[model samples]
Each structure stands twice: as structure tokens, then as C-alpha cells.
Target: MNRNAMTYRLFPAVFLLASAVATAAGTATVTQPEKLREQPGSSSWSIMELHRRTTVRVLETRRDWVQVEADGNRRGWVREQSLSMDAPTQNAFASPTRQPVGTDLPPVPRTAPRASNHALLLSLGSAAPASRQDATHAAAIARLMGVPDANIRQPAQAELTLDGLRKALVDLDARMGDRDRAFIHVSGNSTRLREAGRCSTGFTLPTSKDVLTATELAAHVRSLAHRADKLVLLIDTRAGAGACQASEDTVTHSLNEGKSRNILYLGATQEASTTPANSQGGLFTQALLACLDGRATLSAAAGMPTGRELVDCTRTTLANHPGARPLVTLAGNGNLIPAPVMPRGDAISPHALLTALHAQRDERRQISVNGLRTNYRAGGKPMRFTLTSSQPGYLHVVAASNDGFTLLYPNQIDPLGRIERTLTVTLPAQDNQTRPAPRASQSKATLLFLVTDGPRNFFRAGLSRAGAFAAAPADARTLRDLPLEILGGDNSPTCTRSETRNLGPSQLLLCSTSFGSALQEITETP
Candidate 1:
């Protein structure tokens, strides 16, 4: 054979070898908690749940899914988007020292310092009243999280042109030191475009082009990540088709390839979706702020809310609003405190209070409240619900709201909360269970059903009103006490041998005799 013909054959073999090597070169870190499915599609049974920052070996890929081998040799398929590849050159932007047009760069710190929290907020739709409100609320949250006033910045919406955005990022990048924590929140409009067979999204600014591409934004984020111990990026905008997916990929790659191992990317909507608005503002923002509001009340004893708590609370608050499914990527162990824990206050949001209760909930004894309507209209049919316990126990049902807490069960008409394993109790005694129409302001509430080994009174002695089903007021402090009060408080007659588990900053308690608790969220319609 001629020399050229032999060389051609060798080239093909070399190409195949290089391709295989490339496929096997790197590992992936879970950015989102996802189940490793026995098969690629969503319907397949899950082998196990892969949590954030769990490293896995990628064995092969199939379009949107990748087969991976996790710890203990457990292998299964997960969505490609749920994992971030370890790619060194995947960052979208240039070095932090590189100044963009119309920005003055500050002196970059040369050495690592003790990590501190910093924040930068931008509101692109300054002309809109709602956007302005969101921006103001976001700034308050940053401060509550312990970001110093000097370390936080919020550029005027009118000045947030493409150049203005770059200038702000450059300034934040310069202010950040190695091992510091940074938070960047952008509340604005968004534009999506497809060019050169690639889809990219951008924040619509006030400049001539009025759009800052996702690639550019991610690059700046990457630059900041290099100096940060942890970083959180919150994008609240009207996302178009491919908007969330493209930005998520870009930001995920930015963090994965950077020195920072702990990061969070929270987006307001899914691909091609728009978040719904409420009197407070966008539902997503309202949910987020509500969660933040509870930080002081709901956070662990030592400090602020963890990344996991915020993600969980935000998800729970927005669960009822299908149009606002947040795209969350929490990439770290659950120990990272996103903010400083605030002093306890009565202004605690219901969602935050729920988070604290949820942290202590254990369902081993199997108790539930059923037939409760998720949504009720004003002047609607009578509300009816049944409570069942797998083991014999005393039932205490408390309804929590922003206004206060109420002992909805065991009221005057019923008086008896004790139940048997073989029996089910229906509220209102089938006589006085009907409720007066709820007002517009009373649109939401959460019901906590606690089945304990012994009877417990959530309300004070002798504060009942005159009615068929007279109930006493239970304050926020009463509800916040939760399972601990149920298990270890002096009021529990038969409780004994209570133990506590310290998880990072939060300490949860367990009783020798297990109790069951369930929560139901109620929404009122007009």
C-alpha cells in the first residue's frame, strides 16, 4: 500500500482513541438534587437520590441523560442538566482585572482573606413600579443576611445600561477578596435570541442594544467566583423560550470550573415561562422574600438560613404557582450559611416557620389529615377533614398564619382531642365545623396536625370565646416551639428520654416514643 493510504487509516484510529479519552477525562458534581433513575426518562424507577456536590463518574451519555457511577458502585442515569462537568476552560468571561467599556477597575486583592458576605443588586425595569419594589425588598434582605452596607451596591435602574451592568460587576469583582461570599441579584426584563445555531439569553438593560448576553454575565460571575468562597446568583426576570436553560447552563459551568465549590443559582422561571405577579410583586420574589423574612425566626440557633433551607422554602412557597417553577442549583454541602441568623421576631413569615417545623418532622408513626381542601372560595362549602393515627395518641391541630396561630381542634364544641389507633376523628363534630367565609386578607394558612403520646395544650388556660366551636389564640412563639414542646416540654405528662441531634447550626430533638406530625397548606380563592 502507498504511504498516504496507510497514513489515512492511522488517522481514523487516532481520532477514535482521542474521542474515547475525551469522554473519560473528567468527573461531574451534582449541582441539583436529583434521583439517579434505573433508566433515562423521568418515569423510570430511581436507584437513589444524588445530592448536591456528590461527585460521580460519567460512563456514557444519551442526549439529555447521562449514565453515572456514584459512591458504592451505584450506577444509574440522571439528567445532564442536573450535573456540572469539570471543565477548566468552560468559564464564559475574562479575568477580573480586565475592565469592560465605561468602567473603572479597582485594585484586586493579591491574597486570600477571611470570608465575608458581599452583595450587588440591580433592577432593570426601574420604570415599572413593581420592579422598584422588588429591588428595595431585595436590598433589605441582603442587609438582613449580614452583608455590610459598605459591601452592598444597588445601581439606579435608569443607569443600568449594558455598560452600567458591566461597571457594577467589575466593581463588585474588585471589592471581593479570595474566600469571600458574594451575592448578585438581578431583577429585570429578559430577551432571548438564537444565532449561529446557539441559543442565548440576556438581561434587557437601558442601553442602545438594551441586552447583556448570558455568556457575558456568566463570565463576570466566573471571575467573581475565583475570589469567592461561595456565591449566590438570583435572576428574577421574564424568561422566554430557552432563557432559563441557557443561563442555567452558563452559570453552572461558571461555578463548576471555578475555585469556589459552594455556589447557588436561583432563577425565577423554567424555560419559556413567565412568573405570575401578586400585590407584593412577582410570586417568585414574594416567595423568596417571605422565606428571607423567616430567616431570623427559622434559622438554626448559631446563624442564618442554609442554602438547602432557602431552596426548600422557596420551592414550597411557589409550589402552588405552576407558572413560577424556580430553577435552583445548590452546589455544596448543606452546611454553608447563606446569611447571618437574625434575632427572633413576631414578623416571621409562615413559610419560614414551616421550614423550621419541617426540619424536625418525623413520620415514622404514620399520621395524616385528609379531605382538607387545598383551595376554598369565599362562602364556599363547609370545610371537612379527617385525622387518623397509626398508633393511639392525643391529637392537637394548630392552624398557623401571619396573623397568629389558632388551636383549631379541641375547641369548646368538641373538647376531646384524644383518639384511638382504630378510630378516626372528624373536625367540628359534624355539627359546628362549618367556617364563616374567609376575607380577602385571610387568603393563606398552614395547618399543623400533631399526634403525640400524651395530651398537650397549645393555648393558655381560659381564653376561649363564646361559640359552638370556641377556640383560643395561640401565638407565634407557641407554634415556633413545635416538636420540642411536644416531646420535651414540662407540659407533656408521659414524655421521657428526649434526645437531640445537632445538625450544623440547627439542633433537632427526638423523643423516646415517636410522634407523628403532618402539615397542610390552605389557599383561599375569591
Candidate 2:
């Protein structure tokens, strides 16, 4: 056909296409299994899977693909051919005519192939010299994670003014990618006010005329959360009794409520509680630094601590301070490693080691191991514990300490680990002819027990003849599978035991997978 004839022939189809694009609103149901991709092309990375019948809000159309906002506010693109324009009759997707109301949606953020980790370590220290100290320690922690110094922003105390704070936040946002990890630590003095049954908190910096309110600060940090895979916020604000006496919402609540699930907040104190005065630094910051640096131990996997570890350690560190309550709100998985503190002789990243361990644990089957006491005086009596199981199985116990792993049970003196439904064992068996002295100094130990349907020999080659203890390998793979293993040495990351601290005398140290595992902590004092 000639040009004039072809133009007339395409006019109708073009008109229809314009009409469809202009009025493309409301929701659509997935016709089949589809990929929610990062971009409109099929070659784009899949953000998530859109199962059959999943209904999503249709934001806009791009030729063969359509942009959608799915559950959890996840925005991505799905093939138009995979979607049914008909919206669901019920649930959150019921309103086909309803369009998103309120602020204009920001462009979908893009994540790099290998995301980088960033930190904003603001001193905010005007009067409190300790705030500056906290910043230094936090920077050290960030360095361990391999975050470059340029990625760690430490604004001067004088630059903490209202305008300066905004500029700093903007600068940080510019540096962050969608998949980046963010660590934000703010240390300063704070004030809380209660009026008309509402509580408000503000950071009071001597250098700034205006106090930085929690609400204002959260607004800026909230944006960062949307751009990062994980954002850990550490607030070490020292508040007076007058600011903490009121019974109401806390500064933490204001900072994280209805925010992104990627955010993990660790505040110094809760509402109606004041941070104890610490000459070293903010009490929470001090404990955090200790946990990150291995000086203080709460819980660890492959020699690296998780977010829960930091929280548990902080709670313990502040337990003695009257009216001091450390506040923690974990919007993300607390089990995930917050800091990648690569300790000496450790070749594995904390996340990889934990992931490997988790794959070995079995959650369906459970075993409980109990100790006589969680605490013991140094140079006191030898430790003893009982293992209980519904099913008879072989037992393997390993002790973890600062010195490393030692196979406590199945040793030279008592070789057999065969157990019935219940068994009680002593550290230095009475059957032993030579008596070993008690622990000379104060230290903490985690006794991990793995009971399997069949016998599993882990670290058998490393066991010593005299003490009946085996030294574990320093490699990551051995450390990962050592927790739980069955006969024949299969890869079992199913029963990766999690570590927790108990307020009482007896604490549940670790619980593993289907292999039936348990762990208990023991404190030896001098």
C-alpha cells in the first residue's frame, strides 16, 4: 500500500492504543505464574514470583509489560500477557476503580548487582565528649564490614544544625543504592516531653539552637530504609529523669512505626527510663562496640554476632543501671548478622556461615538439654548437665568458648555417647582417675548437644586422648556442619541452633533441627 493508504489503515489501531494507555488504572489478576522483574524487559532481574491468581495494582502500561505495586509495597514489572485485566472481587485488591491516593509515587529504586554497605556515624556531640567516642568506635565497626571510609559519613558536631542535618541526610541518600546495607549511629543527649497525652522526644545538641526531634529525624532515615536491603539504626541519646518519667510512646516507636521492614532500630533506653551516665560512652554504644569487637559475647555463629546478639548484650550490660532500659525494635530478621566482624583465623563471612548453619538445622524435631546452674563461681565445682529426648538417639556435645571449639562429650574417659530417653553427665566424670582443676578464671562457654537418629562422628580425629577433648577445625565449612550432622556425613544445615540468653539461672542456649539438638550456656568464675 502507498504511504497515504497505510496511514489511514493504522489510524484506528493507534487510536485504540492511545485510549488503552490513557485509562490504564485499577488492579489486575495474574493469569499464570509470572516474574515481577526489576525492569520492563524479560532480561531484567526478577524481584519476586507472582503466583497464579495473584492480584496486583496496575500502575502503568509499557507495551507488552505492565508496572505493578504488589503486596508489601513492592513495585515491579510483569508481562502484560500474564495478567487478566479483571480485578479480584474481594481482599485488598477489590477496588478496581480505586487509584492510589496521596503523594506521587517515587520512581522505583534500582539496586546494583553487588550492593555496597554504607554508614552514617553522626557524633551530634556538643556537650557529651562520649558521643564523639561512640562515633569513633562505630566507624571502627563499619571498617570491619569492609565499608570504605568515604562511605562512612561523620559530620562535625558544628554541622548538626537543622539545615546541616538535612544536607547531611541528602548527601547520604545520594550515596545509597537500592540494595545497599546502611548503618546509622547517632549519639547525643536527648529530651522527652509529655503534653495532651502525647509523648515527643528530641536530641539536644549544644552546637545547634534547634533540637532535632525524633519525628523529623525519622522522616529522613525512613527514606534511607526504602533504598537499602538492611538499615540498622543505633541511637545512644542520654536523657534525664524528667524526660523519661512520662508513660507514653518512646523515641524508638516514633522512629520506626509503619516504616520499611528493612529497618532495625536499637535505641539506648525505653520510655520512662534514662540512660545511665557512662564516662566511657553512651552505655548502649559501649555495649554495642564491645559486642562488635568480641570483648563482650552474647550469641554468635562462626565467631560473628547477629543483631539479636547486640540487643541481648546491651540488655545485660544495662541490667545493673537503675531505671535504664535499652529499647530495640527489629523490623527485619534479627537472626541476620548486623556486623560482618571477620575475626582472626575466620575465613567465612558471618552471613554465609549463618546461612550454611541454618541449612543444617531441622526445626520439626526438638531436644532439650538442661544444666544444674547457668552461673558458676571460678575455681568451683565441675559443671554437670542432663539431656532429655523423646526419642532415643546418639549424643554429641561440643563446647564453644573464646579459645575455640572443644568436643566435651564422647571423650577419652567416657567414650560412648549412646543415650536412651534421658542421660545425665558430668564435665569431669567421677569414673576418671585423674582429677582436673576447675576453671581458673571467669569465662563463658556454650555447650552444644546434637542427638541424631543414628551415630554421627564429628571432630573424632581432632579429639585428644588425655583430656577427652577435641579441637575443631578453624575452617568455615567445618564450623558450619559441626553443629548438626548425621551418619555418612551429609550436608545438613537444617538444624542450625540459635543462641539466646535467659534472665533466669538456666538459659536455653541452642536448639537445632530434626537431628534433635540443644545448647546451654555456662559461666565459670574465679
Candidate 3:
């Protein structure tokens, strides 16, 4: 063959060799890992760090960062530079047809499980109003557990006759699969001892009428302790004479002997009795509801560092009755001081209280997923929802539940759409023994977004469908086709507006103009 022909044949072999070398060098692809950022120069703060590698599946990506799950099933964030687009494989240049890599990538993280649906027994003491408070608190707890609003039983009145209490328990048992624990509310004088069809002081010395006698209430509590998985007892009363002493003794005895998985007892006493104040009970109720909604441990919610508040409150209330333990007043430790009597019926508005409770409940539920972070993307569009606050100055987002109801939060959204910084939520498991056939219900989940310009805000039409535009001054008429709900107005005299629309079977869009223009969409599961 001629020299030129020979050279051409050799050139093909040389080119093939070069191509092989390039392929072996390994391709470098840009990947954005999930990360958590902290402020600079703070003892409690830490800077940006890689949480996971790019080879893992990217659940979602935004402008600044991406969320990924690692091979070991951990999820977190890393800077965009920390990730590379290298295809995960056992051998760098292995043939595509060959087994790609180490045991198939780990399973995706599952959303937190729903709380158990079971009957929640609530016991009320002498105060009829306290019953209502307990019911409200129970509703808040239910929300925290991801229980649908339709599943919660909020009695019309607090005071249930003995028959009513029994019937309520039975009905709740049927609805809740009979495995739920009971909540006992002991407050006020309505529970005073009764004789000859009239209210009167009982013979029991140094004990309050609101609480159970050491013998009677103890037996009932013990029975419940054995039958239920958890028991929450609350004592809301003034430390005074009569049945207060017995009530304390009964509760203390039960706590010492109870074997329930979780037991929470709270007590508050009046510092001084002047005219009855409604705010006192309301405040305690508010705090309790907040705690329950926040899903805070009992100790944190009661502000009881040593778990001795209940013991002390019981001791003081009982000491006033004859034949009771001596009132043991300990030195102050700079804890909360008892407040003087509040004005009678100086209670918070029910609407305001419900709104607040809903906000907290929403917040608690939003943080259910663990080990994730969030960042916004530049090109992504905004989603909007209405923002309403019973109390002004509170801006928050609401999340949907598995059952399709909106859960509101009291604060801003976290990196992973969680309401707060914390992760890990505890939920009660289904009690199969009592509920063989769980109730059949439809899922109608929606998220309610609330932005605040003042203490009390409304979901105005102008703010609707505001998610389509990022904080720009675009005319509303320009974006009429999108699903939006106008809320309030901009800093200018222009009317503020928010937008709301359904995203999918499990998601809702909420947009706001309050904090430098933001759009948030919350998703629910059924």
C-alpha cells in the first residue's frame, strides 16, 4: 500500500487510544449538596458544611442549594460546589450494561408517620369552664398529632353530666379505636362536694372538692392507668381549704404508683384571692394549649424544671384543709411567681385563642421531617396563600396533614419547609385491639397561609393570587388567570393582597408581600 494509506490506518488507532485515556479521567459534573448555614463569630454557631454527596438522589433543587439523600439514608445540605455530577458506579469506567454500583441506592426517607387515632379521655373537675379549656387543649394536641379536624371531638359545653361523661368516653373510644389515653382536668369550685342536691363542703379535711378523694379518685385513676397508654392530669385551682387537700393527696399517690408510659400533671394556684379573674384560667389554658400544640414535653411546657410544681401545688392546696400535710413553702429559685387575681372573665377572645393555637399546632407539625434544608431558586415562581393573625404581628405558614386539613404555624418556615428548627415528632400508634374497623373518611387537605400587617388581619381579595409575581409592582389585572388570593397591601397606599390556589391533591400555594416578598407552598399527605 502507498505511504499515505498506511498513515491513515495508523491514525485511527492513535485517535482511539486518546479517546480511551480521556474517558478514564472521570467526568466531573457540578452538583449542589444540601447544607445548613450559621451566623459568623458566634460560640453556638457553625459555618457551612457538606451534609451529603451529589451521587445521591436530589429530591428538590433551588437557586442556591439542593437537598439529597446519602447512600446511608441520611439527608442534609452541602454547598453547590461540594457536589459533582459523577455517575455513581462500582467501577469508574464500567460498561453501562454492567451492575452500576453498591447495593441499589438506599430507600428515600419516608415522611413522618401520622399520630394514632384513638379515644382521648378527658376528665373535668368542679369548674365547668375548665372543661371547655381542656377540650380546646385536646383539640390542639390532636392537631399536633396530625389528627384531622373532623376527627377531633370538641364538645359544645365543658360541663358534661356524669352520664354525659360516660357517653362521651364511650363515643370517643369508638371513634379513636379505644386505645387513647385520658386527660383529667381538675380546676375551679364547681367540683365542690355535693350533699342533698346542693353544693357544700365535704367532710374530707384539707382537700379540695375539685379533686378526687384520695380513695375514690385514686381507684379511678389507677383503673385508667392500667387501661390507657398515657395519662395527662391537670390541676387548675386556687390553694384553699376544703376538698383541695384530698385532691392533692389523690394525685400525688397516683403519680407515685402509676406505670403509664407518659404521665403529665400541671397545677397552678392563686397568689391572692380578690375578685375572681378570668384571665388567670385563660392564661393557664393558653399556655397549656400552646405547649400541647407545640408538642413540647410536659416539663418544658409547665416551666417545671424539677418536676415538682405539681407536688408543691398539691401540697399547698391540701394543707388548707384539716388533717392535711403541712404546707411546705420552699425558698424561691427565681422561677415564675404567682400572679395576683386577674379581672373576672378577662379571658382572651375565643377567635384569637383558636387562631393562636392553630398557629402553634401548624408550627409543630411542619417540623416533622428530619435532616433537611431549603434554599430558594432565582428562576422559580412564587406560590401564595392567605396570612391571617388573630393576634397582630404574627406571620406564619400552615401545612397540610395526611388527612388534608391545614395546619398553621406561629413563625417563619425553616430550611426544609419545617415550621421550626427542630425535627422528630412523637405520635401515638394505632390501638388495634379496640378498633377493628377504623372509621372511613375522605381526605380534604388544604393549607391556610397567613401574613400580618397588623394585630387582626383579613384575607382581602386583592392579596389573592399574588404568588405569580415576586415582590414586583405588577398590575393585578396582568395576572388574573392564576389561582391567587389577595391578602393585604404593599408599603405604599396600594391595597395589600395574597394569592391562594390548590397545587395538587396534597399541596397549597401561599404568597406574601410582608418580608421582602416571599412565596411558600405547603404539601400534605393522605
Where is model 1 more than 4 Å wrong at Cα?
A: 1-116, 195-197, 241-249, 257-259, 270-279, 295-304, 321-335, 342-526
For residues 1-526, could you state the per-residue lDDT of candidate 3 as single tens digits?
Answer: 2222322442344344444434442322222223433321123233333322113334444554544443223344434455564443221112234334553322112211122222242424334444444444444444333232323343223334444444654564444321233445444432234434433321111122233333354445455544433445454444444432233333454555553223444544442233243422323433444323221222322121222432343343344433332223222111211110111212222222222223222111122222222332222333322322232233434333232112233311321222222223221222334212432443222333443332211122112211211111122221221111211122111111111111221111121112111233333122
Q: Write down the lDDT of every candidate, Cα atoms only.
A: 0.56, 0.57, 0.31
Off by over 4 Å in 3: 1-115, 118-134, 145-147, 170-218, 238-247, 259-261, 269-275, 279-282, 291-526
Candidate 1, 263: how far from true, in Å?
2.3
TM-score for each of the candidates: 0.40, 0.43, 0.29
Model 1 per-residue lDDT tens digits across residues 167-200: 9899887765444567888776666776345666
Among the numbered candidates, top lDDT falls to: 2
Report, for all candidates in order, the number of backbone clashes: 3, 17, 67
Q: Order the candidates by TM-score, highest first — what do you get?
A: 2, 1, 3
> Candidates 1 and 2: which is better by TM-score?
2
Candidate 1: C-alpha lDDT: 0.56
Candidate 2 C-alpha lDDT tens digits along 1-526? 2222322442334344445435668667665677899999989999977655455668789899899866434679999999878522111111123324442322211111011557787777565546645665676566555354335667655677878878878887887644356788887776776534667777766675577777777777777766555677778776644544535335456544654445667776443243344545566676666556554435554455566666887676567445556564443445545654433454443234424333233333467777669887754576678888766767887666654466777777677888888999887633343333555667777666777655555643233344556555444544444432321222221111111111121211111113556656677776
Full candidate order by lDDT, most accurate first: 2, 1, 3
